[model samples]
Target: MKKIVIVLVLIGLSVISAISLLKTGEVRPTRVSELKSQFLEKATARVDHSKFPILQIKAASPRDLTAACLSCHNKTAQEVMQSNHWNWERPEYIAGRGIVYLGKKNVLNNFCIGVDGNEGTCARCHIGFGMRSARTFSYTDSTNIDCLVCHDNTETYAKAPEKGGAPEPVLDLNYIAGRVGSPKRSNCGVCHFYGGGGNNVKHGDLEEALFEPTRDIDIHMAVDGVNLSCIDCHTTERHVISGKMYSLSSMNRNRSHCESCHGEAPHADNILNKHMLKVACQTCHIPIYAKAHATKTHWDWSTAGRLRDGKPYEINDADGNHIYLSTKGSFQWGKNLKPDYIWFNGTAGHYLLGDVIADTSRPILLNTLNGSYHDPDAKIVPVKTHNARQPYDPAHRMLIKAKLYAEEKGQGALWVDFDWHKAAEKGMQALGLPFSGEIAFIRTQMHWRINHMVSGKDQAVACTECHTRADGRLANLTDFYLPGRDRNLLVETAGISLLWISLAGVLLHGSIRIAASRRNSKRG
Candidate 1:
């Protein structure tokens, strides 16, 4: 009898081990298991979609998913109430309903009351906790940006199924939803890129630029060893998501970098700034480009000139615009005349601002000596040169070495070069733009823009719109702003392809399981 009991115990242990392996797909990593044990000693992984599911309530109704969430998080509710994210919607009396307005454009709110609020188009970003209804009801008057809104990844919640019950529950509810976590990309991208909506006077296209791979530009979030969430940089407070400002680090400012952290002044740090401590860092350390208007700080090229890409851009304006050209492979610029009017060819060879101009143009160049070039009356020379270089002129596009200086007087320039086609190729690679298709045009345009911005045209656009900023501003035009056929469709297609590929693999694996189960049963 004792021998029989031992055999039964061994068989039970084998079954347990087999179950764990099948469920997790690999023998759990020792470190991960240990961490999990320490954090959630009494927890289990919840697999059910219904128990802790997204409670989709209605938008017009008062008892909403948000209200339910606030029932437990009163302090967080206060924070949400004061946040600008909660006030994203506006009452559309013309339509006799409410509409979600992002940044300023109202027409772009696809998640309208007409769509019943719960539509995937609207619900993806505006969803409340425990939202489950076909039509979700949101508190229109209450502008509270709940903490749980974006951190709702109930899919990965792990807890002890028998003892701790349904994984921690989004709050402490009796639901068995999946565990969710803070966004590494998508959550922030939703608002950062204006829900990937129309190309209006918004901000840079963070949606497409956050994921691609390249080092064509620099921004605070794009710098290496400077990992921070959107909230960390954009928020007025830790939990607040208001007072939105363009992340200049992505543009070209190095003042907000890691090396500058804890220093008296970012641009004045002894180790980082190299010693021009008196000058306000942004005076010289400024953003090069981006689409969509933010402050009078961006380069406004909307009414400028036309490019090979069929869009209007500013011409190479005189003095205000620094005309960059390759002189002995250096990013050299014209001499600084009083009210120095420079017009850099947008198609000039790629180079850095600091490397080309060994001497900084000082003696206070502009009457409006503020850093940004976008001021309408910005007192700089206007660009009127059109298609300065013929489209596809191989000779006009060449590789040039350039250096960027931290301080005009003290710092030595950092050397870099520009290769138009190669830069475009590198940008495309970083952006994960399509390799074989009609996107070649977008790639071309994006390359030109990046070249223009880095060329330091007084009136420039952002490289991030086409290039991803995650890895040092990798300009990949093919991925973000394709040449023709509506760039939006290209982005959607890419996303769909990724989704379908993932789903297909999951389905195929499930099918194999069913077939194996059937075969084993028959053999038994």
Candidate 2:
């Protein structure tokens, strides 16, 4: 009986230890507080949301929860209403199509194509409620704002896919509303990380692995490292968060930058610091991306219609990332991918709707990053260039947006019916644009800028990696003269000749000095 009681006490102690470990996973505990509590304590609001009488009621709809939030913070809704997250379009000066509003609404990308016809599914990412088609969706309605999606601390708040951006049915709105606070990593990542359907598919740098990254994966966001959150760098003002991917944002204004926090002279080395003049910080710091998971590098939408036995099938790679899907297409995923370096100014140009494809033979750059060595603002940056083979119209000589997802599937959705012609016609019809009856495939590329998962300073790019003659990083960039890689034969020969001449002079002078010293010693 005594032995049994001692064993039971040991089991209880073991259970408590396991629970403590579960709370603090790999995160290093601090002297004052655990890592999780450190972030929460920093985000402590003036008033406890639990004390509010209005939040106690069980809301019938998510809209009711938004109304309750607006009772006190009414101005926030108006600010979010005008922001790009709500509108998804901004007035931008595309080179040929000057000052036209361009965004996900009209811009044609290589991944999922345009979102004009598939607004219901695409609205999953939009921070709003009850967004249907482009014509029916109310842009002026401030009440459509989803305050809990961003503010909910419970992290239970999630948008149901294909439901016009409605909250999941099981989520207790009352419980979630009472725990509202500033947005956390999980809040922004729910949409951003899951873009292009799955994890790390859209942006190669961003993935689910960043949620609780190791020190080697990301020095900033690592629980053991600096322990920074997304909002720490992307500071918000009124509802507009800083930072813009050149993918959506065209204008250079309101951009978040590393230099904003870490000065231009972040490096202690003079040479490395000087490199900042022409090289962006990300080029060296984030040497490789998709560190923990594979990202979609090449997507072939032409091979999407293949089925196993009347039913669509899917195939995954060794890493469990989808390689082939009957709905999407054959995909080539890459992990620890070295980025394609490009010179980029803050400004960029994008391929808008109705733009005729001039040269269909060569792969089209869906969005062109405007820069060169000559441009003062231009800096060499690492970019993940996602290549794709997608559907386009031969007659119209343009990329066609195929109707993908519907609230109710199999109406004209490409994934449901697998009819390219019908889907193209339906998609173009919704956009009020002419579609050619003929369908063809064209090769295209989209460059996504890598700015996250920054490795430690010690793991930065070595000098020889970019400077060496063989497999040099700057091989594609030939416009400017790089001292190590770029030099004329005459200069090389002259440098060698001068070097030999200096060595001979030193040798002769030393010999003469030695002989004089011997003669002086003999005379003494």
Candidate 3:
């Protein structure tokens, strides 16, 4: 009886420990308040320039970042040491701090399945050679995001730095004027823009041409007079892994931070407004059309049903992971049927026409199904759903398939389906420049402008009134627009036609004059 009681107690203790560990998993215990409080305590301490020379970074190598700065600056080093920035270009996860949060299971690290042949996405952000270097005959340690990599004013900073001498750090009043605080773009931009051999280069362009002193326009690092620095937004906080100025941490991780600036949300979502609350504010209230503004994690699988091959496509748990479709079936795609979908139905998964796929490569296709159908609102849906299962469609079957493969299989191919930049490129192909995805940008802003003028006559012109989703996200447009109201889609049609006609008239006049001159010459 005594032995049985002891065994039961041990079993209970084991279960409790396991449960506690599972809950905590990868969530580090360092609270936002704690990080903030510690930053404040250290930020108060003045930098003793005499002890830590400003010129010390001039000779430092990329690998000498921690050693050069951390030795003298313990608190600041500790603060930055735990940051994703510090661990940016390195392949190994820094212990105690600076861990990458790529789901509980890091698919980037090959689902943490031991870094051997492929060092995962470590080199993309790390300072060493990742897989390519590892495979080479002359391989060393992974490249670290060293301080000198960006700050050293010796080696030329090129897109590709094949020539290995350190580039010169071009200092202007904007960067070295001490006008801006620490952690501004000038500092962060150095590593963020150029570090890890330019891995995290997204959203904004950082090319030298974009920032030529002569040019009046530069979108990414643009200022009215001078360039911006890293410290401008980074402020004093460290361990900053979150995206943009709107991140919870950027607003100081406090609810008051949001309310104080914006006041109460004009369209605050609550339990009463279930649909509105579920959707993020950015979906509707986007201020700008910045490409890298925000990203949706889950793919829009609402159109997954359209991928059906007409046959009874069986859902297989072949790998014990659920992915609605698999390639191990008899009726393999591309091998036999030449799908009619336009954009994403090709053999290589590229936008090409008439390519034959004689083998199975379980490519994902998008819904290229096109036909004007009335939505739930009884309004005509303007969206072009080109059936990917068909051929020559603009829908992305390969991308969807890639995303699914990543989800089901612990690892996947090195290619990602669609980034916003890639999406912009696609939009550019469809709609010419100066109008590439910029239409979506303009349309989004137009909605906001209309919403802001809600009190006035524009209240009736809100997006929900005319262009609404099937869901209750949109208000009924019937009362607002009087039965059939779609005047906006044809808004610029007349103006465009008039512009083309005017150009043609001018060309005709020129042609007549040239023809008459030729006839007169023959007569003379």
lDDT of each: 0.30, 0.86, 0.28
List TM-scores for all candidates, in order: 0.30, 0.86, 0.32
TM-score of 1: 0.30
For residues 1-524, could you state the per-residue lDDT of candidate 3 as single tens digits? 99999999999999999998997686653333343344334232254332445323453443343354445544654545445444322222222323323211111110111112222433333333222322331222223323333332322332112212122234221122112223433334444444112221121223222222221222213443223233322334454433321100111121111112223343322431342322222223322221221111111222232334543243523332222332211111111111111111001111111222232244322112111112221212111111122111122211111111121223332122222333334422322222122211100000000000001112212354324434332232232332233345465688788899999998999899899999999998
Q: Which ten residues in a row are the worst by lDDT in model 1?
A: 442-451
Deviation of model 2 at 473, angstroms: 1.5
**For candidate 1, what is the lDDT?**
0.30
Please tell me which predicted candidate would have the highest lDDT against the true structure.
2
Cα error, candidate 1, residue 322 (Å): 28
- Pairs of residues at least 3 apart in sequence or in different chains that clash in candidate 2: none
As a TM-score, model 3 comes out at 0.32
Q: For residues 1-524, what per-residue lDDT tens digits would candidate 2 score against the true structure?
A: 99999999999999999998997676653332443465544555877887799998778888888888889996877888878888888788766667988777778888898777787888888888988875578988777888888888887889897877888999988988888888888898888887898999989888999888898889888878667889888989998889888888787788889887677786657789899999999999998999998999999999987888888999987889898999999999999999899999988888777779999999988889989999999999999999999988889898888898765656788888877888888888887778978889999999999999897678888898888776788789999988778779898899999999999999999999999999999997
Regions of model 2 farther than 4 Å from truth: 1-41, 493-524
Ranking according to lDDT, highest score first: 2, 1, 3
* Model 1 lDDT per residue over 1-524, tens place: 99999999999999999997897785644542443344333233354423343433322322244455455455666565444344333222112222323222111111110112112233334423222222233434342233433654543323222221112233432231133344434455544454322211123223334433123332333434133345443434545543332111011211122223324433222433442232222223233333222211122111112233543233233533322222111011221101112221111121111111222222111111122223222211222111111111122221111112111222222211222333323322332332221111100111111111111123222333223434322222122232232337687899999999999999999999999999999999
Question: lDDT at 205 for candidate 1?
Answer: 26
